[model samples]
Target: MELKAISDDEKQRYKTVVLKFLEDLSYNLDDKAIINYINKLKKEFAPKTARMHIIRIRAFLKFIDHPIANLIELPKVPKRRRRLVIKVEHVRDLLREIDEKLSGPYRLKLKSAVLLSATSGLRAEELYKLRLEDIDLENRTIFVRAEIAKDYEDRVTFFSKEAQDVLEEYLNTFKPSNPLFSKKSLLHQFSKLDTRLRMKHMRKFFSQQSDRLGMPTAVKKILMGHSTAGDVDLSHYDFQDEEELKKIYDEYWKNFRILG
Candidate 1:
């Protein structure tokens, strides 16, 4: 599943299958034992979960066979794609809760990371690809290079004082030249505490914030990294000045109490 890398519960599923079929088992009971295991799982879990559990078991059982019993066959359950995405409010809550509960550098880093994503509409991959050079604190701009972006185009996004302060503090304490968005980019000291939050929720929350602020449709689209194929280019239109952009960003942060 696509969630294996991120899902907290997936490791147990993989281990159960490998451990059951490959470890200290008699050859003659293979087929019946596999069937019995499936039955037991079916009784204990829902049909859907039973199927998922079976996949892991079957994958490991594919090569092994018993001397007297025929090998068990697995049912191929059609994979269901997860369409549910985290809501914007949830993202806001996550950041808020983390800010209130988490302590020290880890707290500031997470607060800044999620806030940056929500405000700038950066993707998880984009967050991981950030470089120290990408952000210009003096100029108050973040340069998202084309190579790391899906559209193969460069874009500039601005930051708020809270983000700037956290980042500046982080930069002052940690010297990193390579990856900007990953946990390792923070510092060896924070490595133990870094908990990588998904970036998609940040983008979603940003969109909601933009909507609440009555941000122009075009500006919202650009901020969300969505461009209409036939639409006129935004850069070709009149662009707002840095001061105007700052007002919008500041107001957004103000509402969330992130300005403090």
Candidate 2:
């Protein structure tokens, strides 16, 4: 794929992993050296992380026509259980903790982000790249633009009445035009690494909430910006009306409200 085809976030991650590997290892790209590098990665990273880095390395080696690329076997990554962090009370506690830790502008920013993510099921990057025009407070909808989406497919997501109230206040106060979450401004007071991890979990919370509400698997995937194109009938023949989607969204999402 062309450089422009992938999002900057993904590219940056790949670059970081590759650079770290290069920095640690000598120039020898033989089977033994590669295996040693994999061992070192396995020691430092989780199995998933190690596997991802190995995949990237394998791709790069293939692109370069390296001989050892054929000899490299991918690490066997065991299936891991997903951590369910979508309990409304747990999310409320986290939001409260964030409020206690952060002050002034950034606190509100983070609160809005957490709330929005829980309600809308947007990926972190999608939330970051959200434009002012993408939000429709009147309609209670957020348009995840094609350009910012991980799959490069455009879709719509909705926020709850509670989330709409908070989001409206945030938009009025900050008046952000382009990027909704500006690291220089909104994240100025916070550790970027910590905030990034929190945002990731928040996205997972959205997915879990969707499941808890008994949303159809296809609808849940659509709401989460995950590709539903895997099913030919659902992708091409089935037409989901916006009103039907909104009804489904509202039905199960009301239970997601953060309780005191």
Candidate 3:
């Protein structure tokens, strides 16, 4: 599993689930035992979350050359009917609320996080793992490292000038050598704010706004670190150089701008 490049968090989850399985079933390792375990998980967690647990458990069984791994099937997850759309005004209001209710370094750090997520479509975990070395302030670009990326693919993503300015201010003030944001700290502060928006919503905001502004689908996928496996443009056509991608992002910056 380690050689497979599974993320640390994923590895930990697998470990926890496997340990529980061993404690409950005591190496019974039969189809019935697995079914019982999955039933327990369904009662304890949401359908999607329980499905994830089963998937991880199946991977562990396969790793150990267990015959039942292939026979195990995943439970169906209900599809979400409503998708939340975040508008520019929503983001503006959230930022304004943060500015009014918070102060000092915490305020700047949270603001920087919001802008970066809104403009770059970076995942929350990716933002938390961001380091000073990953950022190029002059170019307004971020280098998402392979280990930190969800898909474990290294990619370059651009941020708006607004994000650059705020990030520069935060860096200049704190001069942090560690990761740019702490998952716990940022989430805690965000929860305190009186808004319907969550950190996850920022990435959706970026995706929607970019599409509205006419960003090519291929470019959007690349910037967001999404798999373009069968995409004709990304697969056959020559990929845009960093300068070209930056130019495209710059053209959409007006819509991305959250504050004056």
Candidate 4:
């Protein structure tokens, strides 16, 4: 592998997992050793986490062209029974909780993050990697750069005015030079919240609200930076026009707006 597209945190995770595997198992990369290590992982970690560890280990083995790579089997993980649906009320309640629990620059940072992610459907990594230049307050648009984007493609997406207001306040207060938010610090503060709500759920909220407001599926997918590789309409249709996208987002803003 090519790792240029992987985020720093992802690379670190892969490194940590591989190192742990080497430390716990034999230095010699053998099929038996790998299987034993995976079994130990299943015993020590949750099913999904164990599955992830195996995936990382398998990637490393394949990178070195080990014959055992093809023989390794991933442990089964239980599928989710239902998808978590986020609503405007949940976001409102969370923001109220944040206000009651936090203050100063930290409060504004988290507020801006939650609102932006909720409105723009940005991934946590994408939100963390955003820079001052990537945001256009006047237009209420965000530019997801190719390097930071999950799909490794550049895309412009719009945010609600409610998000824009808080974001503008945050910028004026902190005036960051680059890399608008610290991923470590942001995640640390977010963990302090008492709710089970997560940053990823904010994106889900945006998707849910967009569908509820009658946004075209292809347009919604484009806004979320999803790949059009297999989609017939998205792959062949011209839905990349920034102005047109902004107009559609504006039309649905009333229903999608999370705050006044």
Clashes of each: 1, 0, 0, 0
Range of the 10 consecutive residues with the lowest summed lDDT in candidate 1: 186-195
Q: Least lDDT summed over 10 consecutive residues: which range in candidate 4? A: 251-260
Candidate number with the higher TM-score (1 or 2): 2
Error of 1 at 241 (Å): 8.3
Give stretches of model 1 more than 4 Å off.
1-93, 96-105, 183-197, 232-256
Question: What would the per-residue lDDT of candidate 3 be over residues 1-260, giving only the tens digit for each residue?
Answer: 77876668878988998888878999888888877887889899988998988898888899889888898888889998997888889999999999998899889999999999899999988999998899999888899999899999898988888888898999999886578788888988888899988778889998998888888777887889888787889654227787877787788763357886
Q: Write the per-residue lDDT of candidate 4 for residues 1-260, one digit (tens) a residue.
A: 34466657789999999998887775877777877778888999998999899999999989899998888888899998987788789999899888988888889988999999998899988998898889889999899999888878999998888888888898898876567776877778778889778777889998998898888878888889888888998765445578977887788872356655
Model 2: CA > 4 A from native: 1-53, 183-197, 230-238, 254-256
lDDT of 2 by residue, 1-260 (tens): 45557657788887777777666666666767777888887898888878899888887778779888887777778887866455777778777777778876577777888788878888877887787788888888888888888888888888877777777787788775677775455445446323334666777877877787787767767778766556964564236877777778888884457744
Per TM-score, the best of the predicted structures is 4
Worst 10 residues of 3 by lDDT: 234-243
- Which stretches in model 4 have alpha-carbon errors above 4 Å? 1-4, 7-50, 59-67, 235-237, 254-256
For all candidates in order, the CA lDDT equals 0.62, 0.74, 0.86, 0.84
List the candidate numbers ranked by TM-score, top first.
Answer: 4, 3, 2, 1
Arrange candidates by lDDT, descending.
3, 4, 2, 1
Supply candidate 2's per-residue lDDT for 94.
Answer: 70
- In candidate 2, what residue range of length 10 has the lowest lDDT sum? 188-197
Query: Looking at candidate 3, what is the lDDT of residue 83?
Result: 76
**Would you estimate the TM-scores of all the predictions?**
0.54, 0.78, 0.79, 0.82
Candidate 2, residue 152: how far the Cα is off, in Å: 1.6
